[model samples]
Target chain A: MSELTGYLRTDGRKGIRNVVAVAYLVECAHHVAREIAWPHRDRAHVIGFPGCFPNAYAQQMMERLCTHPNVGAVLLVSLGCESFNRYALEKVIRDSGRPVKSLVIQRDGGTRATIRDGQAWIESTVAALAEAPRVPMDVSELVVGTVCGGSDGTSGLSGNPAAGRAFDRLVEAGAACIFEETGELIGCEEIMAARARTPELGDELRAAVAKAARYYATLGYGSFAAGNADGGLTTIEEKSLGAYAKSGASQIAGLIKPGDLPPRGGLYLMDVVPDGEVRFGFPNISDNAEIVEMMASGAHLSLFVTGRGSVVGSALAPVIKIAANPHMYERLAEDMDVNAGRIITGAASLDEVGEEIYRLVLDVAAGAETRSEALGHAEFILTYKSFEPIGPACLPA
Target chain B: MTTTDTRLLLLSDADNVLVARATIEAGETIVVSGTPITLPARVIMGHKLARRTIPAGTPVHKYGAPIGTATEDIAVGEHVHLHNLKSNYTATHSLDAARAGAEGQEP
Candidate 1:
């Protein structure tokens, strides 16, 4: 394994990079959020949601994001009329000892003045973040997650398996690695179950995937994307077989819901699909929503595989794009990290590409910005959804 | 890493076809399971070639997995995908109807 290093945070967690974030509580606050982030653009970013109504999922997502290890300081821009829990979110960040400030549009005399005040506060916060001392960090303290979007034929053979190799390396180094979208794991239940450390844990793993399928079926969707069909994939079962490969070869440590943190270090499944009747349209509207949940659960970085070319990055975590199709990789070389499609082209072995990805993870973890991050693609989204709390079987021993 | 006389041309390994890795011009001989067969037309990369005579409604296989079902009887070396095969999981049609209006859909 290559030697790894990172910027250590006050929480004893290692951050791949230090970034300041300006958050808009609702669509109405987006402008001020952007304005505040603009002045400190090099070190600061604007990230927010467009929803107006109060959502438990959104609030929880916001809390997790504002306090993410990568963010050294946060500025919350509230419309002052929206129902988002801005105060609670501010408190979470403040309590974590990171610099945090909330600017309410209503109290600050609307957009113009709020932007002025917000920018001033953000500039000062950025300075403070810059002055914060960086401590020594280790590889074992890292948390990573993997998700695939725009999958094609090479995904199962190359991209996902390559990510699995990286996950295996990360886990062996004592880092927490997570792979999710249980809705896509429908057909791999038996295969996934066999990898669990214990029979009981194996059964729980299968049950979690079953729950995701049932939840999606309630919405009349099968987690089958149109792109899957376009890429020579034929069935949800076939897609599941590929999607389940992202978990790597680690023994299943535990099963978890969207926001639940792993109790101990090992590979875990994140069930992003909601429980009960599907009140919300789909579990996750886009790929970034799933990425957000994994970040909230403490993944410091994300490995994103795209066969059809996805150019998205996360707001708080750096997203490493692994292109699975050789043609797609050639077309989108500027936006990708490692091209697993080389395996299909027979230019590289699966293990070779996998090792490349594994090495890339350590480099990205040690402060090398990914193509998506350098392009400032901080795409984030949170939606309305309800989840029945997990039962005892979901946690590890 | 290239194997001689063993293309191992897998198409679900359950179906009766070899998926095209590149465009196979008509009359070009390709090896599958050490058996040399000629192409009927231009078979695009990512498309499939019939491993054997495929009957209509038979499930098409790739990587030992069923990708879709055949909509018509396909002769050996014929291109498979939206034109000849359709997805059983989702109601996607053969290659033509599926790729209709969305040319260059693949990267």
Candidate 2:
């Protein structure tokens, strides 16, 4: 399958959209960042971390995001005195050959003055980005990620498995499809491992689930929350079985932590848990954080499956929502892209909805705006965490 | 001697039990390994029931793996839920108890 033409970046990467970013360095800088993006709307989008505390993980995440494929330029809105490493972060973006500017509210006259300067920079950046070169894209060059949130009883039977169908088709088409949150794959570890391409890779898959189990056990909870329980899931492992179906039946290509790119086009698992210890409050504070990590790993688009419903989209990627429950689908029809619930009600088959999702992925990659993106749901969040490097066995050879 | 009715789904040959696709009623006749017997209770769709008579605390198998253990003796077609089965590591509740707890709690 040939991909549609995409915007070619100065660094030789291709993007479906050219977006200008406004990032808040701390909670204090959030309001200014929001105000700056509020007027531009489509052209300028807001993304940021709020913790005043310095985190290597946060610093790394910021660097990856500012240089992501969809980002044409960056405007860093800092409180000027926050502990974040803004200088180094901005340098990373500039080094990628993208336009970047930093506004330290403390250094600039004040909020009113900085907003004025930020708007001027954004307006010019938008103009220059309009002139950025366009080039033909290859289907194999795409990185797609999938996630399921707000799951109800029907998620596994419909939305998740339908996402699995789309994932399988995407991988067959040579797109690097990623499914993550190892913590949610706890009970399905054995089955997941058996699907790995090689026996060694199989062991690595099992170990990742074990790590998630231990990590969550220490916290006295599984990746499951109160909402999941309210939605008819009885135990952690039951939730695991349903969540794991989104991975599809593809062979595991490799395991990558946040900020590590997949080696090639295949299915990969993003280990959202930190490499060691339980110091971080939780692996991810919300679904958006997981989406951000997927973007950092080079996902050009995301397939978000929801049962209870979430209307979140990424700043640099299009999010296609597959509604899991028919009731929820009826309520959020305009907000969602596909209703996998039709499979449960007998209106459609899993393969049909899956094909619908697969078609939507291509349609979005070809430049259609997702409902979330159209409604201005550019939600982003990052936080403090620590990690050691993955061992040699973590990835397939 | 006449033949009896049975439904089988081998997800994989290695699997010990196959999942029930539709509800099976109590006292309904089923034949496994050429032996005909009546069901103990109604087995709901998507829920696992024993392929054989599994003793108490034996791991209940599904998807070719152990999902949980039988809390009480589970016969073929018995409703396998909180009363007769529980999650291996955590707790599970039957819809009845869950609904009762819901009704008992005042808003």
Candidate 3:
């Protein structure tokens, strides 16, 4: 058994970091939330929805994020006019047995009062969190997520495949590993479906990818970014193949939406695309949005593979940045945690890099700071979207 | 998987393109599939080159998967990018028009 330990939550889930989440319910309350967490930024983080309109998806995501294993306490900051049911969110966090307090700009005075009150709450909460019980946590109890951003040709040949190998190792150790966004896995549906744990789940996998293809076709744009082309990725298909490499070669145990936690330890596919005619402009407005969705699904930490380089980290869960390009790694070494780029430079093999990533995951879980985390990069974003409850085929008993 | 001071990597035997393991200059020559071809232009690291002469409309392979079809007859050592390669599903988005705006293409 591994010797790592974490903060044990009331739900029996363990947290690698006991983060005090200062959440803004709407855009108007964002400034107050940021100011509250700004001083105690090391222990407290700011996260929120900018939407003035009510969205069930946003509400559910907020609830899941507030009660995520990594979070110790939550402070909700609301503008008192947003449609986002802040009371319902506060109730959920309170029900989860965490110390939750709310400050409405209208009810609890304006920005100055709210910021003063919120900062006081975070201070007490951080001190209280220090007394939280440290319980034994195993690698098998971990939930790991991976997303590739700023991708290029070498991403597939080096970092991505190496990440896949790492995923294989994680799954082998009985950890729940999730790889996602059917939009990015467009061209690999056939190959991905073939690796499903069940034949029925395979069909669900194919339909999810097909739905993504249709969704993007209607929008007139794939997830391809302009930086992708400059990084030497030619088409969405090519990029899809590279992105799909992060999943590794393992039997996909289940399929899930943004907030659906995996029932067991195995590989899962997260469908970030919204259900019913794509009303949302894009499935994920930014890469951080994707990481937020993974956090909602209970990912304790994330492995971000980037070829062109991305310096983003998540609020609740720590994000481990894996540099895919040797040249890019050399330039962004301070921002990077693992160098899968060594595979490209012939300094290491895929398995060697993969092993390095696995060890780093454990080390980070044991309280070692990632480069992004060390630099205080706690980026987060959430938006409106809807999803039908996952079907039975999604999780096989 | 061999990378002993190599400038190019042929990811799969089924692939018709070779990826630059490191940036290669225009005058550089590399052997591929037992045939030597001089680089027609500087190939940046993580960029692709036609490993063999790819006929127009043929699928381009990388990582042993079909990435997209070639839009023109690409010669060996020619840089394979958006100029000659197009996605079969949808058009790849680029900010060229905004760059055209840089060239004063927009008012």
Candidate 4:
């Protein structure tokens, strides 16, 4: 019923943009990978892990990311000495029916030769991707992720709930929406559990938040940052309540991990906190990391709500920045897409901003570039982490 | 300016503190429920101001939920932040103090 069209992939998923992902297998290959994608930076992006040590979770994340619907092709740049299984990752991309190539700096006559060869592949692949089929797409087929960063007191009051309003509209229209950060959801778990579709799912939701609370307790830090206090936010629970507003009022359909896709259109919670004994230093290193995780789970776009202001965008998906502070909004006008801060100034109501977000989502899906996308903000990040499979209670059959 | 111009926003009905929609100056008078109250100090935008007298160790409410407990007695219209409030579950850290002093917000 929507006027949107998308690039059709072999996996039956549609992509808003056919991005060429130039992935480096480890830190050693980062420079070469960056150079190869620099000429076609608008269409190609660099992403990868820095660790030489292999982790099953990192491998799985890379596989999901390479095969993500938005990615039309992938180039694996390996230093050859790292333990990352570049061949396996390359095969996964090839099997997914996208063009795949690999270059080893150690074997391909070092930096200059590897870059020269990698750029040629990218140049040709970019030409081929322009011809990828465009099929009709709908809101129901779109997956959106919402996250709040650099939040202040105004975040919950204005921007977050506005985004939540948009999420409500999207979910009502049968679109899949994901809201994450279980650590931030600490104070709101019972309320979140009450909205679960099933009693068993409610238990899972509670357990996940419980795990986050314990995890942070062991880490000797809450998710609360120093900037948060500088902006008048005193505690983590207060921040959780504000962040929880982004989930909207839809019934919780399921709980998912970083790379897990929602079975159908509804709202799902991504358990971002790492399972086990804090093997990974933090659940997500920064805002960009969580955005990457959302893209790995098939999110076509993300709504980033910021009061203190964040300018970062994702490599594969577009980010729509919603400014929560009016003063900060004026200071960073070019970086903002939605001025939710207007709600506080009495220029716009909460629902108006919400409706505005709804329209913007549809407009963006129709190939309109977000401010970040227009400003050349294809920022990316990935770190080591692990996840156990989701239990039956997490997703209702 | 019009009286409709909100200098402070009460997020939830059960909230005990009102968030400053704009930076309110020290000694500025703000009408709350038709009673004009004078602020003793400035409240920055996105910061909290006490709606009523709050005793030591009472939960401070925002968005109708307990954000943390008050560290000391807080009077009406006073700024409520890390100096006076702390999380019940975990301690908040800031630049100055090692435990429960400042941060904008994070999740």
Model 1 C-alpha RMSD vs. true structure (Å) is 3.2
Of candidate 3 chain A, the 10-residue stretch with the lowest lDDT total is A225-234
Q: Name model 1 segments beyond 4 Å from true.
A: A1-10, B1-19, B23-27, B34-41, B49-106
Interface RMSD of each: 3.9, 5.7, 5.2, 3.3
TM-score of 3: 0.96
lDDT of 2: 0.78
The candidates' DockQ values read 0.30, 0.15, 0.46, 0.49
Q: Where does candidate 2 clash, by residue pair? A: none
> Which 10 consecutive positions of candidate 4 chain A have the poorest summed lDDT?
A225-234
Docking class of 3: acceptable
Q: Could you tell me the lDDT of residue A285 within candidate 1?
A: 85
Worst 10 residues of 2 chain A by lDDT: A225-234
lDDT of 3 by residue, A247-268 (tens): 9999999999998988889999
Residue A347 alpha-carbon offset, candidate 2, angstroms? 1.7
> What are the per-residue Cα lDDT tens digits for candidate 3 across B15-52?
88888887777777677655677766667788888778
Q: Who is ahead in DockQ, 1 or 2?
A: 1
For candidate 4, what is the lDDT? 0.89
Question: What lDDT is reached at residue A2 by model 2?
Answer: 71
Error of 4 at B5 (Å): 9.5
Candidate 4 residue lDDT tens string, B47-88: 888887789989999888898899999877777887799888
TM-score of every prediction relative to native: 0.89, 0.86, 0.96, 0.96
